[model samples]
Target chain A: MNMTFFQKFFLFFSLAIVCAGCGTDETMESQSSLDINPLSAKPSLFDQSPSNMAKESLMEYEEITGIKAVNSDKEMIIAVQIKHMKRFFMAKHRKAWQKEMEKQFPGWKVELSTDRKIYLELDKLEEKINKDTLSKDELKKEMKHIIKLSKEQT
Target chain B: MIFFWAFVVGGIICVIGQLMFDVFKLSPAHTLTILVVFGAILDGLGLYEPLIDFAGAGATVPITSFGNALVHGALQEADKHGIIGVVTGMFEVTSAGISAAIIFGVIGSLLFKPKG
Candidate 1:
């Protein structure tokens, strides 16, 4: 049927609202009987000693810079504050590094922020360094080098 | 097509907002404040989460999302700091989004002269 722009707009809007409202009900109903377990029950591979060591290194770096470091199995996020710089500086630096990373790795991302935070995806590191193929000592040395560089940057 | 629907939903919301402004003879700023407060109330009642799930970006890319952000931030802060949360919670959660909006809005306003 032919309709004015406003009429069409209102029709679509009302439909969307109704659909959204109905979808919630559907989700609740579907989830009610489902035996879904939270992922917390199973400890991740990164919960092991090497990952702990990596996290410790990040923590040490943060302690020195008066910043904070958050390490997860997948990524490491570091935050710090520097004097006499605008807040946007962090964003700019992050953007620059991200661009550089994109150029080097094509699809991989390394996020840096003006907040004195840097994030490196562990999966990307594993892929780049062939961590699975490396010997244990080689892996340790590589991780140490990475930790050193991360600390030096801040 | 998903992005298209998102824009359409956002545009429709804006239209309704404009209509409300005209019919009630309300200032845009006042309308915005009221809408945000209404969104906060809905979020407090735990109704907004469903809307977010359904509408995806449609619900999130609106000014109402800002209200949701405020409510969520406030609640999280309250959880952490108790009564002092009233002052700190909203700012902590929503500061990044709000600050960015303000900075961009200011930049846009300065760069583009709007005819009254």
Candidate 2:
């Protein structure tokens, strides 16, 4: 009573699939068991921590191209500095990074700068914003100026 | 446990991509497109949501999820606006990603000099 090789193979394959389907080890926590809808399950960027945002922005910079984000500082604007990759000299590469930054942080200025002059201003502005010395209107005025400057160079 | 499944599932997906690139000799672009289209088709059939729930980022991080997001957006819109939803829905949910890619891609082309 010899079985054909194909029949034997099919039998083993079916059994393997059945075994895989029947496993019941649910190792994940019950956090998933909570009643979470798909709509609400989507990730949101609003009201997130600033430091984490900085970290992720740097990560995104590195991911987009091979270039590292040399620096990141979040103030009125989210300033992310990319290393002076030769690619940055490419017009398309700079635009791509610029668009990439804006996409991540909409309505918030994410200036992608390689210029030393603008990079210095970005850090100084962040320092002022952190100090909280300026009044609300004054802060608003400073932000406008910073935006203008960022646009002018980068 | 969640992380474990996420790792396993994500690893499997990546392995498939690697195999296609290495063994099958498929280009990276073709592999990515195929995965995305496959995801979209699965989403249309209502099969992908369960996999997403089970694998989380394992499922979502892959290029396939881009197609899933596109189909998901369309399906959601179809419920609201009838046939017109078919067209508008494609971009509604995934515009953030698609727009960024397109805008950034164009900018990169314009700003940088390709290696000569």
Candidate 3:
């Protein structure tokens, strides 16, 4: 159909408004997941060593879900995979939380791999915390405990 | 149908420009420049605020939006520093985008061996 310029402008303008409006509900629904404060909440340090602190943080994360953290010094990587329903949302929160952890630890560098892997340096660990490497299960358990500690802090 | 609507909206904007040129006997270059300046001025006056409120991406994802950004930046700078506004203005507004473009362009040029 032949439409006048004004008609066409209004039609497209209205359509844009409708499309934006439709997404508003979904955006509102997603707002809770986007809450920055929860992720911003400070994580208490139970382990002094950078490796142990990273391990402890990962263990806490695992406790919340059944995920496992794998640390690799050679590659400078630590990562966890979880099948949580809110995986994407939780991952975003975890990233923010990791940033807070980095700030808390200071002097130690932390890097998160693109594939949701977290890596930490062993030398940066506090002298008091044990430097011994954790097995997969031990890491998982420790991560759970860390999550519990984090929740209690909240 | 969507493409039709896109064409229609784009055509309307062009048609308005054409009408302004024909009625006022404005040269094509002058008309184009005037349209850009007018858009910038309206954006500066905050008249584009309602348009942005109504059509978020529609108002923003256009060349006119750049004009709006420039005007907005100029105004913001004017607020801080009275007369030397224009010089400091564009940097405050478009710095991030300009920096990214420059950095990426340099990196892309260096890395990519483009075919003639």
Candidate 4:
């Protein structure tokens, strides 16, 4: 297209701003598997009697695309994938699901997040659990690490 | 993924604007007004939110976001305080962008000479 030098400069400047705002840690090449089975067969990490209530409650939320959860003795941590558009209201959804999960699984401190990074990490942990690769102690350590990461503020 | 989507969507929007200016011979002012109105209409139809979700700041940084923000702000405030909120809330989310544009336009006019 024929354009003045100023026009070209303006177009590039705007595109640069758009790209800068879109930067994230995620790669376009990788697909997240965490959403495939949000509640994988209760791995050894969850020694308690299994409950479908958590899965059923999670499924009720129309915006959720995927889920991964693991629990230690007193704490249950969950990472969820939300439909991109609905993410604008993440705080509301996070609060709603947190409340629902708490009600479903009483006597446990529940932690819920929609962060993609957390979902990826949990997916890896779940993979290890399925393969019988992670020890109970290592599993606890990993859970603690993931939980800390979730609490981190950017 | 967000980066890719944002670039693609923002690029397409910019392309459409460029086409309007070059092919239709529309003034910059007219093109911008039309885009903003289009955004507002989309917001009214509940379609802009999904676009924002898909494109992130790509959708937000464009001029169309001005329209979306105007309507969104008005609706939110109207829900809380009724009709008067429409006037007050219209500029709530868009104030920074609008104020910056005016201030910069003044400074630019003072600093630069027109080409034609």
For lDDT, the strongest prediction is: 4
Using DockQ as the measure, name the better of candidate 1 and candidate 3: 3
Is 2 or 4 the stronger prediction by DockQ?
A: 4
Candidate 2, residue B5: Cα displacement in angstroms equals 2.1
Scanning candidate 2 chain B in windows of ten residues, the lowest lDDT window is B1-10
The true-versus-predicted C-alpha distance at residue A28 of model 2, in Å, is 5.8
Candidate 2 residues B1-116, lDDT tens each? 33555666887989999998999899999999889998899888777766665566778888888898898888878889998898888877677777999999999999998888
lDDT (10s digit) by residue, model 2, range A1-154: 2568889998996875555444423312222232111111112211224433444544544422211121222433443333222322334445676676667666654555544355465556445444544455554566567668766610
Candidate 1: docking tier: incorrect
**Per-residue lDDT of candidate 1, residues A1-154 (tens digit):** 5568889999998997677667656644543342211111113223233333323333332212222232334443333332211222434444554364345434322232323213243333344333334444554454545555555510
Which order, best to worst by lDDT? 4, 2, 1, 3
Q: Where does model 2 exceed 4 Å of error?
A: A1-154, B103-116
Off by over 4 Å in 3: A1-154, B1-35, B113-116
Report the lDDT tens digits of candidate 4 across residue range A76-117.
778888765566677678888889888878888888888789
- The CA lDDT at B69 in model 3 is 74
- What is the C-alpha RMSD, rounded to one decimal, of candidate 2? 18.4
Clashes of each: 4, 16, 14, 2
Q: Estimate each model's TM-score.
A: 0.42, 0.41, 0.34, 0.55
- Give model 2's docking category: incorrect
* lDDT (Cα, tens digit) per residue for candidate 3, span B1-116: 22333344445567777887989889988877776687788787776644443344445544456567777787777878986886677667656556888999999999998887
Clashes of 4: 2
List per-model TM-scores for chain B: 0.75, 0.83, 0.60, 0.86
The numbered model that scores best in DockQ is 4
User: What lDDT score goes with residue A63 in model 4?
Assistant: 76
